[model samples]
Target: MEVKKKLLDLVRDKIRFKHYSYSTERTYIHWIKHYILFHHKKHPIEMGKIEIELYLTKLATNDRVAPTTQNQAFSALLFLYKEVLGLDISEWNIQALRAQERKHIPVVLTKEEVREVLQNIPSEYSLLVHLMYGCGLRMSEALNLRVKDIDFGFDKIYVWDSKSLKDRTIPLPQKLKAKLLEQVESVKLLHKQDLKDGYGNVFIPYALEKKYPRSKLEAKWQYLFPMKSISTDPRTKEKRRHHVMAQTLGRNIKVASQKANLNKRVTSHIFRHSYATHLLQAGIDLRSIQELLGHKSVETTMIYTHVVSEMNKAKVISPLDF
Candidate 1:
């Protein structure tokens, strides 16, 4: 007996086939499910351009979602109709909700402030914050790091399948070398204990798992920041050691911020932003920063220039002088 899959299930299959990130898959599925429910569960194949516009307009005019959130929903729908349903929505007029341009600069911590925040965080997770700032890694990138990704001899951190499906290498901070090595020893000890307990596998990327069935147990494949306990793999249903949760790191940062008496809205990403801004302030060229940050465009890297203290010094004229 052949059982048919639901529309959302088919959408999930398509997203997986395309190798989209898990976060993107979740976001797309959420918006698609919302769109379906908003339209009385009408199959997306039956809904066209007009339905999308109405939903987006409601989000802007009634729900008042921010521009970026609205844009994300729009992208999800676009993928659904074009990629999943094979419908041509390009010809249909899409009156998307216009979001106001973001004018505020990103919040960045000074060197002293970063030091204070790190001091306040628990020692177990402080290294993660250092990696975020030092290597310009996003929270996911830092947490997803494997044993082989950190090349201590070469002083490089290999970032894999980052945003935009791009892989990049960042300079490993010399100051962090000893601490990272210690951390690696800890992971090795944990892995050895797990293997002794008859569970030593780590989750590999979907395609890689299929290609190299034995790679999951390889020492180099273990997460650098493995979680404290083993868990069942959601996809494979086998108990494996997963990396530390981003939320745990985020919560620690919030606590550290309060303890440090910082006045800014701080998050894990703030470290990455501060990294770029600090590099720009140090006179690094925009092109080089772009490559280090894995930004596809130099323009994206240029945003840090606006927030660097050097720019403020050059651009702001004091009223007292006038």
Candidate 2:
């Protein structure tokens, strides 16, 4: 029991050392625990490529986990072996039965449908929805937005260390300027109150906290969309004002979709999909769209082309019409 506890502690230490997000740290810990329990709590140092392959194969064959989920599990184990345990995994070529990957078109809301849903969304999340669709931002990107990231003078919004681990800028939506400024002013006031009450520090990303020691207390470092109440930092256990939880926005989106009377399923990501599809429909070139969406490959951006083609099919003259 002591050995198992120490092993997980090492993984957590390494993860924090690398400055991974709290959510990522949690995911890695969960997968690592499951992997150990799957092997009857054998220490990972005693295992190698064959044990890794067997566990992954069981997930696909017996548990039937999705491809992405299986891949996440593989990543956790790989991190444990390489980073935490100081093992070289360069030649571990053991192949496991891979989960079958299925490609499906993402659900997108039409411009009118998007407007209807936005109208139904509670005022609290309205600005967030607008930004998500206007900038084609992922939910995390939107939620994690910092005051410094919004470049009002330059008319750009900087996205730092996104899912691709790359930074990119988006054109600030002209329609949202007033609301955004208002939100900034509101944050400034709230941050003042928090500081006066002796709890105003925000969570700084990566190694910035160590480098710029005073940044945590700066207004510019605060989350753009903060929660109504202060919450304790999961890692530091410090009382800090973090951003609104993803689940809060997620549940409200479901309720807003129902109120809007939309026939299709609605999700936060659907707004992003709609943003890409609408741009394609508006004659925006795929290459430019790829840059705006921060896609690593044009091939990934090409999915929007397929979506547009499917929509265009409805305009074709049928045999009866001819």
Candidate 3:
């Protein structure tokens, strides 16, 4: 007789088979576990729409979860039922508590503020922050950059498999060109040393790893910002150097912000917001900014317009100026 797999293991298998990001898999698994435990360890197979609705309602009311949090939980459970358990929830009416839509503008730093924050951070992390603000890159996109992605001749950085799993190129900052080249040399030396120690493997995407078996050992395939220490790959268990962790960058930015005396909340993403807003202030059009930011919809990019509008209002000129 064959042994059946655990439900969460089955979920993990399906998630990986679909090529979902590890973060997404972790988040989905977390919510699924919470859902199961919330119902006193009841099997999800025995639960249906009503059980899901009750769980979601508890998240909203008793747990005081935000609407988006509740929705994420719902999505996780939905995936569990439809994909893992092979259940049809199409016609089920889920009367769960809904979170109110928020309209708060994103926090953006002024040019001077951005510079101040950069000045306070270490040189290495400052470069990362610079890329985020200068190129409007997400933290992950910046960290995941490979040596081959930087094109000096074209004067652009190729951002592959970004937030929406789409690719785009942004102009490299002219000021950072020399620094980037220097960093490349440093990476080459590090890679050489790593290879000398017989531990130079880097993680490649699944499809590419299959297509180019030896690419992982190539210099061009090496991470631009490799982690200081090697780690075990969660899936393969092979020891390799991954990209710098996003949390490290986040913490560095937080420390820099505090040191810079910034009263506003600062995070890695604030650089991206500042990038978009500064471009709009410089008379760049929304469509172009949208493309630079790799936003799927111009509508999603319109939020920066609000930020700029608020800035403009602060500088209002009265008729007394005449």
By TM-score, highest first, what's the ranking? 2, 3, 1
lDDT, candidate 2, 129-191, per-residue tens: 889999999999999999999999999999998988779999999999989999999999999
Residues 85-152, candidate 3: write the lDDT tens digits: 88867668888777665788999999999999999988777777887888999999999999999999
Each candidate's lDDT (Cα)? 0.87, 0.92, 0.88
Between prediction 1 and prediction 3, which has the larger TM-score? 3
- In the predicted model 2, the residue pairs found to clash are none
Best by TM-score: 2
Clashes of each: 0, 0, 0
Query: lDDT value for candidate 1?
Result: 0.87
Compute each candidate's TM-score over C-alphas. Answer: 0.92, 0.97, 0.94
Q: Which of 2 and 3 is the better model by lDDT?
A: 2
Pairs with backbone N, CA or C atoms under 3 Å apart (clashes), candidate 1: none
